[model samples]
Target: MPSLLEVLKFLGAGVLGLTLGVEGLSWLYRRLKPAGSSRISEVLFFPCESHCMESLFSDGRVSGDQCVCGETHSTALQSSPVDPFYRMLSHLLSARVSLDICVFSFSNFELSRAVLQLHARGVRVRVITDRDYQTIQGSQIGVLRKAGICVRHELSRSVHMHHKFCIVDGRLLLSGSLNWTMTAVQSNQENVLVTDHADIVAPYLAQFRRLWEANDPARHTHSPGNADTYAPRHHGHVHKGHYADRVKGLVHRAEVEKHTASNGHVYQQ
Candidate 1:
């Protein structure tokens, strides 16, 4: 058995290491995400802003008509596809039994609004958000639970949970780079993999459970700081039956269209 002082020292060192590691990784990520011809995961559906909607909706060989996800096609404006993000939010709002969200931070207005709506609908919304930004994002926690959403903070060393994922009805999951923040939807280069596979969703569910259980008050603590001052900048193939191309075919698309450059490597724009 170790002395209490030794245990404390070890814990302190571990926390410091986690912080440094995250900062280092973030720097490297900034370097690699330049725009060029580097191939990425096949995009299925993504949000389009003002400029690309017109070009994207034009008829092409792969798609007989304009992409259905286009914002405008003819005289009348069209609706965007209900991508995974919207689908997940819709399901959450419609959930009668439960809604589980495990995100590093919970600050986006749209996302928070959806949670509140779900609460109003009598759905049990449980959230596990990062404690680092609790002071900043924490204000909404009380508001959510007051409306009936059950929210919890993950008591971990890292400033970020570093995982953006959600599971719904034990049947569907949305996981990947998209965080519950304004930039993720509006400007950042991010992608989320949505799936209906229980096997993949199981591990994430287990991780959330373990973290939630480990959140004992006496075990973790953080020093007070200006929490609101910082805005921390932060796949799969499935087979379907043959001959039923309508039900079996898959669509790939890009998530964000931002230019990035690195040591001669360019990514999608």
Candidate 2:
């Protein structure tokens, strides 16, 4: 009934129609499918085998059995410049509950301001440092003490209170060779390790507590003539009441007050 040429032409038309229909269906499927479905399907099908690989790719996006979708897959390390004063300031500012600091020296005005600000915010703060160091001309111990922040000096004069560390909110520990001073922060080469690791924090916490208890200010007596002069109590000796009068005289004469700079640092003038 049909000629050979006509039959060939009809078969060719049918084949073309079938190919076009298949192409149209493929385009519609691609359009209707959700984005990232292929990645999810690949992950589901392969499933990362190794623990590290699984952790790296656990977000359901895979590349050759590796996860590429996890945000935390890549390790991140933070570092500070040679001058870590700003970093220290940031850490101090972020404290919500308490701050414990021990250093060989602390004379930075900016650091003093940060401590005062933290105290103002109802965050408990404590400090321990070398006794002789605080007697320096620009030392901030007097300012800190005047502000009602608990400041203590090491009892032993022979051994230097050379530790430089800070604990923030009992969670983060900052320690290393850095001293809380403008010279150490701005000029000297120093490093501070800030970590929340429990292994490292626990020991430092214990050490701080020990030092804090051993150097309690109440255990010693201050001379009335000079507030900086501290003498250990003899079991049999009683201190005269004139010591209070001397302290009042010194406070009245010194007239310590908080002087703020444009940069928010508190200085004693």
Candidate 3:
């Protein structure tokens, strides 16, 4: 019933109203969304070295580094179905100085191969694991031992050395519910937290040292072919000095040693 000009004007106003309403709703939604909401898909499996390596204890408070201690970042494959094995491999491939690992179980060949490759490239690699799991059919401890990677097993047969953590280059720490196994990577529900916070890394490093020293290879006897006869191409012990320097500011040496001593009574298998 309206004239042509009036009809056109009415339609134009309706279109303009709809556009403005949509824009307003979008703005409100964005304003209400939580921080890091957009980063939900960026599962954190490794520290971004350039952005995360700065010490967090500067001025006695957490620094501006992207990877802050206690600010947990997680990686999982169960819901998304991504290849967690390769994701973990990518992290190991980034190690430059050292890799310290403590896990309850390990059998994934691809992950073990990545670790062997890292050792071959001159990274100092050490592993602490459960004795029972080490003897499993696909366990990689034998492969690691044959390659001269220092590996130790828990001395206590009753208690399992159930820890799933790895420290890379003394700066980044990876820990979570995930075990180093094919089932964990391929189908099991698992998660990994990666960070470069020195405080978090220090305790784990101390624990690893305790376990490593307790399960000293010199004190234990090995089968004829089990001894690591291959001397490293480089002076790998020098890397330990580098690690010491890295943690000096974050954790007191004496404090760590005391902590280690207090818990050192636990025998390794």
Candidate 4:
């Protein structure tokens, strides 16, 4: 029989191999991400400035309607989307290959619909959320899963998966204080930082890969994940679901429900 020291060395080698395998997976994931220039890089503040509510492109100086914080960005206004929320939605819709979402809660109908649309289009979509909030009323996790999207949740119940960020086509990284909930979008003061920088996006990609594997159903159940996929439909067939119109889907209610901000301060919308 092998001595204790020999067995110990054998176990150590196995552990080292596991580490290398995980690292190899991360490297492959990065290689698969289509590289591109960082065209969209900006931090967006919630409760957008009043200027965002103004008319779009009507100004002779600008081309398309995009919210431009002239005072902060440079001029009073120039060429940019005139609305912040619309910009967010547009980026979400821009995903063509893959979209990954890591957030605490997802209840906002518009955002959920956007995710569904992406899934319908063959874009591989994955969601990682806290276990508790995934089933919380108004959550769209169920909706997403029902549509054949892969959704994972935290393994522990004592702690929370409170991350609020998403990656589009493995390029654009959207990280911020905003949750994918109605209150976060239309009421609470939140912020979302959008960027496509490789250095920044790489770390998040690794973290997501870690969480996804850690929370894998196979890991927990020792069985392969049988994630559902959207069934093929007839040509030109579309899911006849209707959602509220674009960015300004709902009026930003001045009066909002009570909630706790990230700073631990209790406040109202």
Candidate 5:
């Protein structure tokens, strides 16, 4: 076996070489693609628990569409519905002007790949997350920056940018409580909605811009002030603490629904 130092040196060299190669490829791709050529199109979504996810990640093909007589027929690609995550990846890859993302934590391999793919395609991608959670995603950000994506963190000390959102080309907005974490998709109850409406996208763009524009401060220096004070207040308790008033509110709503159901009148919760 090689000496310990030699093995370490070899591994270091391999990592350095891979990083350089990815950066070089990204540079070449940017040189070839003209800027501002891609346009914003329609947006789509799939509920986090949608069965479509299994089909998307499955190795087996759907074959074709079933006709009225039960015969499988060739289906047009354009009409085929898209998986939500794939649609998100497609938007990132097709971005010409910019791709902006804000999340709490991102460790999913597929998401990282999409970000790298878009960066390699020459689209400007910017990511912002909580400072405390940055180290959890440091490797991903390093890969992103090396591929020419600008990455940063939220400056608000108390809030931690609990928001999960993305803006594609400044025209498309994705928002909700769904963070880029695996649990959020595969287990935790979460929600996300994509909207092409300017009214929705504009405000989120502004919010992201506000957070992005803040200067990066030195660690252990900044103070988290009344920033969290604005958070919604609640009376219910949580496992970590009485925090997450949002979830508390959801629980309260559930109780109210149960109370109403006990009555004779049928009502929607």
Candidate 6:
């Protein structure tokens, strides 16, 4: 029968062997890993409260005060731990030419700051958010608007502009279930997908353009609840097209119905 000391020795040996085996396997995997696999993309999760992303700047590389994203890095204000949302902000700050953002909520202060920084850097920024949320307490929409950023919100009361996406440079795309709010960033579970795949990005770019045109304050002049009357926003020049013709036809039909109803006659389309 083995003594107590022998039993302890056997257990210790087994643990050391297992650890060594794992280390060897990891080394081999790294050596054999395929190239370009790491370039695929990145999917970052949120709610990382313990380790804020400020750590990424711990080496004093980039700082906002200098007005740089990949422009420069700053030293850690907190600790050397990577936070995912802040990582996302870094990517957002890298925008060079344009950023078209469409989202439901816009109350996140850090995000607002990034957008403002981009704008100050001469990046063309367009923001489309929910009409209702634009007035909510702590909303950054008003701030963006006050800064002269082009902001167009949904005019529908029943439906909302719930898209959370931003196209960067007409190439890179950022979209996901994350909301630009502190609660969503610090507590709620969220995910952000960042990709620059052309095929995938092209569609989102088109969608943004469509929404931008559709929500143009000029386009909503004739819409219900809008105070401004319908008029061409661009120097009184309306784009002549099928949509223009359709809008005119609908307005005419509505007027005819109203007049007929007042006279007790049913108007036919």
Q: Compose the digit string of candidate 2's lDDT tens values, residues 1-269.
A: 99999999999999999999999998887678665444211100111111222222223244433545443332211222122343455666779999999988788776788888889889999999876567655788889989999988886544679998989998778888777676565456567777765556789999999999988867777658766666566674644543564455445334422223343553321
Question: Model 5 lDDT vs. the true structure?
Answer: 0.59
By lDDT, rank the candidates, best first.
6, 4, 2, 3, 5, 1
Give the residue spans of candidate 1 off by over 4 A: 1-85, 137-139, 216-269
> What tens-digit string does per-residue lDDT give for candidate 6 at 190-245?
88888876557889999999989888875633635444223344455644453564
Residue 32 of candidate 2: its Cα lDDT? Answer: 81
Off by over 4 Å in 3: 1-83, 220-269
Per residue, candidate 3 scores C-alpha lDDT tens digits across 152-230 of 8775433678999998898778888777776666455667876665556789999999999876755544435534211
Scanning candidate 4 in windows of ten residues, the lowest lDDT window is: 245-254
- Clash count in backbone of candidate 2: 1
| lDDT digits (tens) for residues 1-269 of candidate 4 | 99999999999999999999999998987677565545678887776543332222222344233435453431234345645666687788889999999999788776887888888889999999976566555678999988999998876433579999999999899999898876777677899999988889889999999989877765433213333212112254522221121111112211211233334542312
Backbone clashes for every candidate come to 10, 1, 4, 9, 0, 6
Ranking by TM-score: 6, 4, 2, 3, 5, 1
Cand. 1 TM to true fold: 0.50
lDDT of 1 by residue, 1-269 (tens): 99999999999999999999999997887566654322322232334232222222222122326456454332222244344445445444545676678886565665787777666767666787765444342235556756766666654333356677877765567777776765566566677776654446689888877876665443433224532122111112222322142122111101111212223322211
Q: Which residue pairs in candidate 3 have backbone atoms (N, alpha carbon, C) closer than 3 angstroms, thus clashing?
A: 154-268, 154-269, 155-268, 155-269
**lDDT for each candidate structure:** 0.53, 0.66, 0.64, 0.70, 0.59, 0.71
* lDDT, candidate 1, at 178: 74
Per-residue lDDT, model 3, residue 259, is: 60
Residue ranges of candidate 6 with Cα displaced over 4 Å: 1-40, 50-81, 222-269
Quote each prediction's TM-score: 0.50, 0.55, 0.53, 0.59, 0.51, 0.61
Q: Residue 61 deviation, candidate 2, in Å?
A: 39
* Stronger candidate by lDDT (2 vs 6): 6
